[model samples]
Target: MADLELTGAEVLGPEGLHRDGLSFRDGVIVAANGGRRVDLSGYLVLPGIVDLHGDGFERHLAPRRGAMKQLDEGLVAAEAELAANGITTAVLAQFISWEGGLRGFDFAAQVFEAIRDTAPGLVTDLRAQLRFETHLLDFYNELPALLREWHVSYVVFNDHLPHERLAAGRQPRRLVGQALKAGRSPEAHYALMQALHAQNGEVPGALKRLCMELKAAGIRMGSHDDHSAAARADWRTRGVDVAEFPETMAAAEAAHAAGDAVIMGAPNVVRGGSHNGNLSALDLISMGMCDALASDYHYPSPRRAALMLVASGVLDLPAAWRLVSAGPAAVLGLHDRGELTPGQRADLVVLDAETKRVAATFVAGRTSYLSGAIASRFIG
Candidate 1:
């Protein structure tokens, strides 16, 4: 709306802090220099955080354990919440699984397309991520068309078939009971998982080829929960530039060795460890091994974890900010935002620096949320 300008705040950058004024016209930053001036006396201006993976919004889409809501309103609420948390660029990690009922790709596709159409009216920019399960070949068979037209951010390869592990009495199937209750009989699920594993041998090769198709169309792709150096190397060879929640120290180091950005979830950092016994992000960051932090299931976790890292002396503020903002924007290949650089996108967060709390957020130069009005919120 306004050609926004603000001054008298600590502008975070890779090099360090600077007392500079920043100005934005339309949605692009027009200036960033100490000489420029406006009026944000006590605010701490930081690049808006970028979330690479989060399914918290899926709660709104499927609330109350089994209840469903209108996708339009649900997504709008998700946008408001994301903006409230100061996430300027959000990747909607929509699941594409073999399950063939509600919450499947067909239903998610319509809703995700609706999000793209309605993004202009929402509080933040919305990007899509096809969370492709290795066992989801049935759903994936139709992916070529969706990937072509959708603003697909990244493709995540997952293989969460605890069915085989569960049936052998090695673990419980509680994790995927929802899918099981949706008429995917345990036997059938096991059969599907077994079939998919066999099919996976063929699919990774096909998916590797599909990566070329996606790249030709400008889509980025990545692998999820890679467990070893060899696994990371394999995906790297397939043109995957991101390693999402790599499970082993060797895998994370390998991903880094191969020049793939390593992304971990903030909830993993904040909760003292990972949910799935993976490498602890705190340890990774201690070793300077982590690149970006996604909101994952808890949107506020990223924002909170960034400050917490500073508070705990794990990272000075600028470095912490990079993990959430510039780091993600760079890894995601969006050179348009994530820094207070001139000509960058004007997605920004204004914080009460003394209090270390977000005061307001602007997405594409628009006032999307006022932290003074939402400081008490615990969710995004």
Candidate 2:
């Protein structure tokens, strides 16, 4: 039996964009023919967007200041947004910090169980990315357990203490609390913050220990927002393989030079700036410094950013396409995805280039989303 053929779809291959047909069967692509005569003249298609860094689920987890959202329900809503944005393989960032109050390890643990149990049935293929705050030594206990989980694809080390406090004799909690606008019980928040700050305010010897342990257990390591070349060198020494959003161009250039993958936030590109005032992603792209781009917070940013890059002439469409697809997949060592070639996992997304909108999304050769009339008809 022949697989379903999508012909006349605007397909992006190694060559360039062309009218094409792709055949899907048994959850993988068997053939792709840009010259075929099937009728898909209205839609554009590309490899499914691969997001390497994103952590906004904290928004859904705590939607209304103090309100806790149900994990299963939140995940379902997140998937709809991912598919609508052309993300078929999503590495949902889950920050497992040493902090004790809401959005801390305890809360993360529950979400982990829910993610492991529910991800297989979700609309988009889901992977867990544990953003580890290296300064939090107390999280050592969780590392062994978390490394055992099958869905954990990434483990990033971020040390946020410098930004949280000026000088603290009390505990790391004193300044950290201001970042949140009163979420849970004050006492509970106080205790958790104090306990966390006490342990994480120094260089993380425990993290170095856990890194080796987790590496031995087959987990990949990443470094987040490294501010200098020396920091990148330090992460390299710790066996950290991926550099996510390095704050300086020199640091990112060093990572790329040293054979480490350099990641940037797509939002940074689309907005023409960094929310945290870090190195600009467009600047990195233009200098040939960055390797991959993720929807760090907003899911739609990756697709929109890629199109904008091509339109602005920062990169040709093919090269720009790699930032959202092949680049991140290669960075993560996920060869089975990020390409539309035969024998690869049959994940693909259809978009309307005119409107820069997702028209349809597929995962493993099956439809994950079919946009409604408004989306289908939209032309930008």
Candidate 3:
């Protein structure tokens, strides 16, 4: 909670970018500039990136196969990565799926407990988001209570099963490998998939009931990898307003038409397209269909993609940066930290102007990550 002032930087606030000084105290931006001044004449100061959906923390949680250990340690490491990448507020997208091991309910419960315990001491404002696989009929009755117990406010529905192939009694690709990872035999895994898919008749009703319950609990819901306009519309009717990475333009258009926030991966933009041959994020942005960009699997992609957009003339600096900041913040209902405005949380990212690299990250007026010559500015 040290008072600090950043001077001579081109700061982006609610009014837009301007050369000015910013001051903060007791974790909030204030009008009165009273603090030790640090000159940053050639830097760009902007609000910290808000990532609405990121699973990059999964690598830190379980770096390799069968290496899962302490959840707190992994969470600490994840926060360091997030801060280093200029993320101030993040929603860790942990899966509560049929897939066992790290993505299953037991591991998710561990993550929930760890996050709840470790969050107060962390600089980054970390929150949990549950990615629920919709076809898990047995868990339909139990998920709402678990989500409430975990204090998770955001939930995204995903149906990752290759239902067509499974229903045909054909083995989905890499079934053995997936089963091995889940600590089960291939036969057991196939049986599980068949049993889950066989309950498809009951899934619709179960999903409707679950969504209604979650909506009543004040939990914001989203649909993932929406493949069709009809699919998006169905989720919309069930109160799943946020569309996370619609795979087709029609799906995205449906979400946009319904006034829902459409999220795409930042890495998709950085890489120029989706790795899985889905809709291109850059193309979506150009069409005015994309609302926000999440880090997805790559923690640094948000900043990289924003700059990429600016360099490519798809958007100017303010507009491009908004994809990583204000856009995601609004989607996630975090109105406090996405802008460097007075009376807001003092979460800012300072970038080296020439290199366009993150030089430092500040969260709630505290220096969370600092490096290079920028580190010399604070003479403590």
Candidate 4:
């Protein structure tokens, strides 16, 4: 909580980058300039990234098949990775689905319990997000209690089954592999899929009622991979205001038209297009459709993607950086830390200006990750 002055860096300010540096104390950003100075002449200071949705932590939790028996260790590893990548606040997107393995309800219970227990010692602000598969109708009655127990504030509705193939009476190509991972035979899995698909008629009503209950509980909700304007409208009617990775331009436009935030994958922006041939994030950015960029499946991509946007002349550094920081924070209703302003939380990242690489990350005025060079400056 001691006062610290970060001098000799180009600090990102509301007006844009400033030559004068910043000062902070007591786990909050402060306006006062005089303090114990730490020179960082060749660095660029920006607000720390806030990832709204990311599943990359799944690898740490289960590196190989059934390897992660220790949830605490996996979460610690995940926190380190997030901090190293300049993330200050991260939403761990855990699935509540029938796909089983790491995505099942049982696994989610363990993760939620571990997160609640381990969060106190972590520097990074970790939060849970439930990726609720819409077809898991039976869980509808149980989800409210789970959310309450887990203290989850975010939930996203997803329908990931290959409905087209299933409706055509053709088994999906990866059925066996998926079933094996779920610890069930292909026949059993197929039967489960068929049974779920049969309830597609009842899913809409159940989802509507469930969404209303979640909204009543003050939980933020969103829909995933919306494919059309009509799909967006349907979700909007259910009070699912945020649209996560809308698959088509029409869907994104619809979300924007409704004043809902549109989230796209940071990897999509870095790769210049969706790997699955959906909408292009950069294209959406240029058109002003994408409101925020998430880490998605890769932790490093948020930083890389924002810098890439700057390099591609799509946006200036401050504007592009907002997509990863301020934008996502606002979408998730976190009014505290996304901007480099006085009285805000002192969550920030210092990057080597020449290489655009993260030199240090700070969360709530505490060092979470620091390279040797940056550490030496403070040490000496």
Candidate number of the best TM-score: 4
Candidate 2: C-alpha lDDT: 0.77
Q: Look at candidate 2 and give me any clashing residue pairs.
A: 20-34, 354-380, 355-380
- Model number with the top lDDT: 4
Runs off by more than 4 Å, candidate 3: none
Give lDDT per model, in order. 0.79, 0.77, 0.90, 0.93
43-69 in candidate 3: lDDT tens per residue?
999999999999999988888775366
Compared with the true structure, what per-residue lDDT tens digits does model 1 show for residues 74-131?
Answer: 8888888898788988988887776545456666687667667777677688888888
Q: What is candidate 2's lDDT per residue for 222-277, written digit by digit as tens?
A: 99988888989988887897999999988998898998988999999999999978
TM-score list, all predictions: 0.89, 0.88, 0.98, 0.98
TM-score, cand. 2 vs. native: 0.88
Native-to-model Cα distance after best TM-score fit, residue 370 in candidate 4, in Å = 0.6
- Preferred candidate (TM-score higher): 1 or 4: 4
Candidate 4 stretches with Cα past 4 Å from truth are none
lDDT of 4: 0.93
lDDT of 4 at 153: 86
Clashes per candidate, residues 3 or more apart or on different chains: 0, 3, 0, 0
